[model samples]
Target: MEHPLSQFKYCPKCGSKHFNINNEKSKQCADCGFVYYFNPSSATVALILNDKKELLVCRRAKDPAKGTLDLPGGFIDMNETGEEGVAREVLEETGLKVKEAIYQFTLPNIYVYSGFPVHTLDMFFLCQVEETSHISAMDDAADAFFIPLTEIRPEDFGLGSIRQGLVKFLSALK
Candidate 1:
């Protein structure tokens, strides 16, 4: 596995090669006294339970985890709250309008895109959709479907954080 900051070879502010790893979480430029701390991006995932007690899932359209089962959500947009982000992501990916979303839990995740592992703070929400009659896979999803809670398997979700999140969610219901 590659280091998260391995791609950063030069300091952005000073354009210097004197940039060195200051610590596990940061880098410092000896030439300019500039320090850069790696911070995790905030992401949201929605757990939408239908009237039949089925959970909505989508197949990822792109890599990182292409064609694998995933929850309906994505990276939160700038200036959007977690709830609002979840709502927007659900609408975009699953065509379901989220009427309400209850905060559930948060987990740290490493999302690798284009060979760079980007750390993320993933927030999971239990969501209620305004309507379930209309659902079409769009945006980042190739397909969308529902699985009964009893039939859900952790391994089905390709993302590590989503698998861990599903474990905790299932445990809480038991």
Candidate 2:
């Protein structure tokens, strides 16, 4: 795979061709005196358990891992808090309104998008919903449903951070 900075050949500030690598994580433009840093994007992952203790899971509709299992969450939008992002993601993907979101933990991840590895800090949350019915897979989810915790397998999750989070979550249950 190419370096993340390989695609950026010009400086964004002045559109100059003198952009050069300043460090592993940043680029500097000799002509414009501008520096750009590559930072991980913030993302959220929800671990919603129903009263029956079944976990909510979604089938991915797009690549990076299409057809694999995933949690109901995505990249946080600009100016949105992590809690708000998780709630919005749950509602968007599963049509479930989150009543509350309790932050669990975070894991670094690499989400490859369009051939570029997008670094992300994935924040996990234990979310409670106002209701569990009326679920329909929308947005990027191909399908959404609840499975008993016993049925969950970490290997079933395609995203690395998600799989690690699942293991941590399940272990904590004991």
Q: Provide the lDDT at 162 for model 1.
A: 98
Clashing pairs in 2: none
- lDDT by residue for model 1 (88-124), tens: 9999998999999999999999999887898999999
Q: In angstroms, give how far residue 51 of model 1 lies from its true place.
A: 0.9
Residues 104-162, candidate 2: write the lDDT tens digits.
99999999999889999999999999989888999999999999999999899999999
Best by TM-score: 2
- Worst 10-residue lDDT window for candidate 1 reads 1-10
Measured on C-alpha atoms, candidate 1 has an lDDT of: 0.94
Query: What RMSD value applies to candidate 1?
Result: 1.2
Query: What ranges in model 2 sit over 4 Å off?
Result: none
Deviation from native of the Cα of residue 126 in model 2, angstroms = 0.4
lDDT score at residue 128, model 2, on the 0-100 scale: 96
